[model samples]
Target chain A: MNVEQVRSAVLKLSVHNDAVLSEQGPHCPGSETLDIRHFGGEESIVRPAVTDMHFPEVVFPTSRVGRVAGLEKVRELVVEHHRLIWHSPLQPIFGGNEKHFWKAVELTADFHAEVCGGPKLYSERKGHPHLRERHFPFTIREKDRELWLDLYVQALRNVAFPLEVAEEYWRWVESLSIRMINRRTTFAEPVRVPFNHIAERLA
Target chain B: MNVEQVRSAVLKLSVHNDAVLSEQGPHCPGSETLDIRHFGGEESIVRPAVTDMHFPEVVFPTSRVGRVAGLEKVRELVVEHHRLIWHSPLQPIFGGNEKHFWKAVELTADFHAEVCGGPKLYSERKGHPHLRERHFPFTIREKDRELWLDLYVQALRNVAFPLEVAEEYWRWVESLSIRMINRRTTFAEPVRVPFNHIAERLA
Candidate 1:
């Protein structure tokens, strides 16, 4: 699927109706499901059709993340992600300022690098990373989150992120992105996009 | 009508089920409602039975809040609020360290004073007051928020906060408390306690 198709699918999947899920189960019956194959010959599994309301705690696969890609590549991915966001419809969400945009890219690079076990760059420069609080000034609805994930997918593809740890990295971002949503525009909870569904698209 | 009774009532009111409300309406039919009289001889209104999922932005009544009570009283209220939290079941959530507890009280006092239009003490000392982000480490569930509002109610009553701005102040804290909930322990949204319900009890 193309970026637009992927975006549409992600949005449809993430905002799965709670009423339907409750009557059915965690995996929505008859809803679209993607077969995700695990790396290293593990069993392939079907992506759950619905997401729980719980905002999960992301435990970064620091070792694998750092081993697969160095700091430079990580920085490149961060820059690419920002570039995608800047060029997308969500540009206004970042306040439409070039200086602020680049500054955000720099800070985000530092944060991503630190989270991936590169170095203590973010904390040393900016103190504790209270990310949710920092993003409070912006109004991030559920749709914005889907757009964000779409852009990130493009970034990962653009940078040719190693598939060895791509799923792990995808899981991190997928869960972490939910926490950034400060505003609620819908009764539906944010959707979850398993890496398998995007893996083929990225390839 | 004592603090304990008030706490129980607030807890019961705030956790009003969503299924029940949806079947009924915004104001839960047959649910207990409280009569709240306005300060300036306006009509007394009944408290709504349920709270929406939206986390409201607190607009401080700077003029009235500052006029009715000065910086000293605001500080006292902040300190008293923290004192109550420390003495209550929620004390452990503050890390059980006396030094950290007092430091939080000081910072909070600065924030409260500034928000009440006293001075920019908090922003001067600490860069910005990201209340939600700062509380990220704490597991602030819906019930925790209820307890917090309970204590704040007690603090307001104990300090004899001027009824002139009591409703305004209550609305601010009541809504602001929802923003601090980082964890979701239940499917139910946080309950809202209208000032009228507690006003009679406080009096």
Candidate 2:
């Protein structure tokens, strides 16, 4: 197992743990660990017994491939991505508008997960996930999509899934999200200010 | 999950990805997402059909649980935790480390998963996981563990697992890894440093 795969196993264990709520996999160090007596003696080496994270492989759905793409992976990404966007040293500057920034983060995170191979609630449960239908509600202008895509690309890079995988995935997502823009109505209305694309920013 | 579980998952996924080599498990999106196509062309939103990353869950022996602990909450933590860690910038760094670090990350990840309640590799195969025995082959010093744990804990915080759970999990992990340090027979021992306890690093 690669590091990510083992991580995937640990995550899957948590999925199995849905009801019980412990993480009896690697990094845990086990319960015998709870018994401090093993440590006090001379040269005594103790390996703690895992209390409860492992489980039947039956617990997980069969489609998640690699260390990178599971529902569990998505949830983990969602939480972390949100934390970075909403809680970082720079995020507070958004101040009273923090919710908007987070909403955008959530939006991008969902879109990014789909790109990286995570589950999709908005798209799946609902249908076509009309990015426009959903995002149409936002004041998403071209600048917004560009900015959104910018943060999104960063998140994708931050996640660092395999390059080809990410390329194949984001190539579609970045383009597809364009479907969500209100197009004629939003863009034609004219007040939307534009910003540089990712390439431009880098240049 | 509470951050302890998140930390565990990240620890596991961020490391150990290269260990077993073959890709296994965690397949399929929810059934609701199967086989649909992009609808509006420009607005193309489709069902969550299978991506390459998606895999069906693989079944493993229940006996594997003996190695790891924390059986109480495996369902949610396993896949979920890895999801977050897999995305972290640290993942690439860990993947790039030497074999020793690679193995250490895998073992510790196994340790975390077991502690929080997932699998059991340590006990099933190695009996006690004699940390010193397993580690003596390498030049592991206290500083090594400290640096390792630092990166580990940083990954956890970056993922934003709840602080209390994070701290508890960290304490347990930190407490355990300390035992892995074997005296250096070939080099002068670095001065023992004060504990860099991470009790206060919370979001």
Candidate 3:
């Protein structure tokens, strides 16, 4: 067969499932500066890189919730956490507009579902999560990260998550939260809410 | 100790390598539409999912070049191929400006090295290659894809890539070229150049 024919035939086989354009801003005249207007189109969301359960939260106990509640609980928990953020002072910082905030809630639900050992919803839908890049646009200060962690802790408590499940999930979010800190003032204040504030609710 | 204090201690363990933002365009008033100017900052590049070798090029002979020349050869091969594209009629379509052109060349080299079983430069620097999304801004018709493939074949001839290496690499390019095609008229026309035109140069 003519090599061109062969090459043409080969070209036909390249069927890709998804194609994601680079999130880095385009190189126009005023490209270097972080212009929110130009960056408005694509809200670069990425998957979390760190999945390991850490510390006290790492010592996870077997939970009946995951076996029974599964992804449904994940969605509910994420929605609850988002609702708290939505009403809190940090809402705008965390979620730019109402549409963006709701999108974040959906993405978080996908993340929780995937990371909690359920379906690979996030990766399959969104490709790998570049969490830092996704959060780069926001001025994620130390307090913001802590408040985020607090909301998750509160959400877990409110939902009555199994101790093992709650701690394990917290470990992931807590660590993941620190990386989100792109800005911070002097005096790196610690989290105001107790880490296991949800634990008391269980009792 | 207070649960919050102890939890704070646990929170200390949240370590992450990096977090990337979602690349999907922002949901601004007119964000949904694909505007090349808006997509201008970064020269969008992505990975091809269909990696299978195909057709007469299917029987890939083992290349002594990759074993002997290794990554150095990959760099040369990619650079040479990019140069051909740079000087050719296809230059503007592939690389809009000098800066973007060089960037494309660099990215292409990175991709070549990684797929040739060398260092994972592309993946490390650019995450997964969402080939389709990268090419989304350009109106890639069938002719464009074919011309791209032709350039590769010619480049291989110019560089005198080992028979096995040339064919093997061609299989990849031929397949990859198809994914870059975002537009085409009915009944895709055959390449203007003869198949194995590069092969004729071998004699």
* TM-score leader: 1
User: Which pairs clash (backbone N, Cα, C closer than 3 Å) in model 1?
Assistant: A14-A191, B14-B191
Model-by-model DockQ, in order: 0.02, 0.03, 0.04
Per-residue lDDT over A130-202 for candidate 3, one digit per residue giving the tens place of the 0 to 100 score: 4543554444545567778777777776776656556555545665465445432211232434446556665
DockQ score for model 3: 0.04
Ranking by lDDT: 1, 3, 2
| Candidate that beats the other on lDDT, 1 or 2, i.e. the better one | 1
Tell me the alpha-carbon RMSD of every candidate.
Answer: 24.3, 22.8, 21.7
TM-score of chain A, every prediction, order shown: 0.73, 0.40, 0.61
lDDT score, candidate 3, position B124: 69
User: Please, what is the whole-model Cα lDDT of each candidate in the order they appear?
Assistant: 0.62, 0.39, 0.50
What is the lDDT for A128 in model 3? 50
Summarize candidate 1's per-residue lDDT along B123-154 as a digit string, tens digits.
66654344453554444557788989999889
TM-score of each: 0.43, 0.26, 0.35
lDDT of 2 by residue, B30-53 (tens): 423433332212232343322111
Error of 1 at B78 (Å): 33
Residue B103, model 1: Cα distance from true site in angstroms: 50
Which residue runs of candidate 1 sit more than 4 Å off their true CA positions? A1-53, B1-203
